[model samples]
Target: MARRRDLHPEEQALWQAVASTVTPNIRHRAKTVLPAAQPAISPVDPPPVPPKLPAFRLGEKLPPKSVRPAESPLRMDAKTHARMTRGKLAPEARIDLHGMTLAEAHGELIHFILGAQEQGHRLVLVITGKGKPGREDDHLHRQGGVLRQQVPHWLRLPPLGLAVQQVAEAHLRHGGSGACYVYLRRR
Candidate 1:
């Protein structure tokens, strides 16, 4: 993957300001300092030993992997795609996963999609906020917008995958860069 260009100083400052406003404040307790004391040990006593971690034995069986559906081509007619792009059809349900961790978002997405499919719904909206702007140091790495990047992948995995028929970016009116339209397979 190509590296993203660094944000200008002004842009970085603006992003920082915006990020600071949205993040929740955390309170930390002040540290307490204690006077140092010498350990009392007996000559016959074995040196205090550290705890040992559990060891994995050879040929140890690992947990089974979760089953995921195969990647099938998205099924949608051009007319439907055009209608979705134009924001002509209204979504039956909508889910916003902003401020959620990847695991949280994935679980919520699966539940939402599965529920929508079970309800016989055809179209839905999933909002994953376009992540925070990347810092200069994050150029070569996976930067912000974690949910935006992972949502599609999650939609293609397991139970949710079997239920989704098509996925498309939402129109400007719906959310432009931060949301998408999820068309579910008929029940």
Candidate 2:
């Protein structure tokens, strides 16, 4: 009978660590000739790639928001107001609402009156120009004249009226029939 060959020194060291009757390395090499009973490691598939996205431009502008500009605080008929108040309320401190649209004038006048009272300004001149005189044939134009005609109505309102100590048409120099001096009560 023929005897099996002995393992080399290095192979012997590895073979001692593996206690199996038949070495796995020997089985791996023998696999080329014979079928393997069990495999060591399964093959791994590669990861999939992702799609690319479009890039943004460097100078693109954003959308604008819905916002309005603040209305001007001074909108009075200066000449008319000056004549009416007789310089009682200085030009710098008075609020005139002569040519302003009704809504714009109304809002600003209310704010000014309230603010002046709060700041302890007792004498305020609000010159609302007298309405345009109506021609004999056109009575409709009478109601729509200068702010002077309209301002008294607005001043009569509870908020505005409450702040005033007196309201009277100005003397000719201050504003004549077109302007009025408003005397505000101290807060």
Candidate 3:
């Protein structure tokens, strides 16, 4: 039976002895005071950032994508390469692999790179939109950009690599990290 009334003297003594022998739960430990000598740390400063994007307007027409001098082979000097990465040199050609399965994208990429090389094009853009944002699980059945992860590997392996001189992430206006600059070698 449970007691609602005060414990008997003998019962109280027995309860105290039993309680004293048991260990205290960690979550119920007494709070401790810290010594006052240590200094607090400040938040870290951010690294240097690139220039911000220009403001957008409703229904504004963008200028045509200028084709920079592409008739040359892919032996780019540092300054010219820098110019290309900064979106200063617009891509001579481009392809979007936004919603493709792995097999389709791989085949398309192979054909595109080889054709661009044969056509004597130097710099081409491959826009693989940053796949669905979050990590997907079985329940959601959502997939991230598999193409983005695989394209670079394909470019480095066989027939495609033979024509590729360099592959770099595209500049912000050129789709930022979502796209890549495939600098093709001349045939």
In candidate 1, which residue pairs clash? Answer: none
Write one digit per residue (lDDT tens) for candidate 1, span 52-87: 633445786532231111123447887887788799
Candidate 3 lDDT by residue in tens digits, 60-100: 55422322223224565778688987889889999998788
Each model's Cα RMSD = 21.8, 29.0, 18.4
**Which candidate ranks first by TM-score, i.e. highest?**
1
Better of 1 and 2 by TM-score: 1
lDDT of each candidate versus the true structure: 0.71, 0.59, 0.71
Segments in model 3 whose C-alpha atoms lie over 4 Å from true places: 1-75, 136-144
Worst 10 residues of 1 by lDDT: 63-72
lDDT of 2 at 46: 38
RMSD of 3: 18.4
> Candidate 3 lDDT (Cα, whole model)?
0.71
Candidate order, TM-score descending: 1, 3, 2
5-114: candidate 2 lDDT, tens digit per residue = 65566775564455345434532343232113323432234357586532335674432221111111223456644543464444335776766998899899999989
TM-score for every candidate vs. truth?
0.58, 0.47, 0.56
Q: Go through the candidates in order and give the clash count of each.
A: 0, 14, 0
Estimate the lDDT of model 1: 0.71
lDDT of 3 at 42: 30
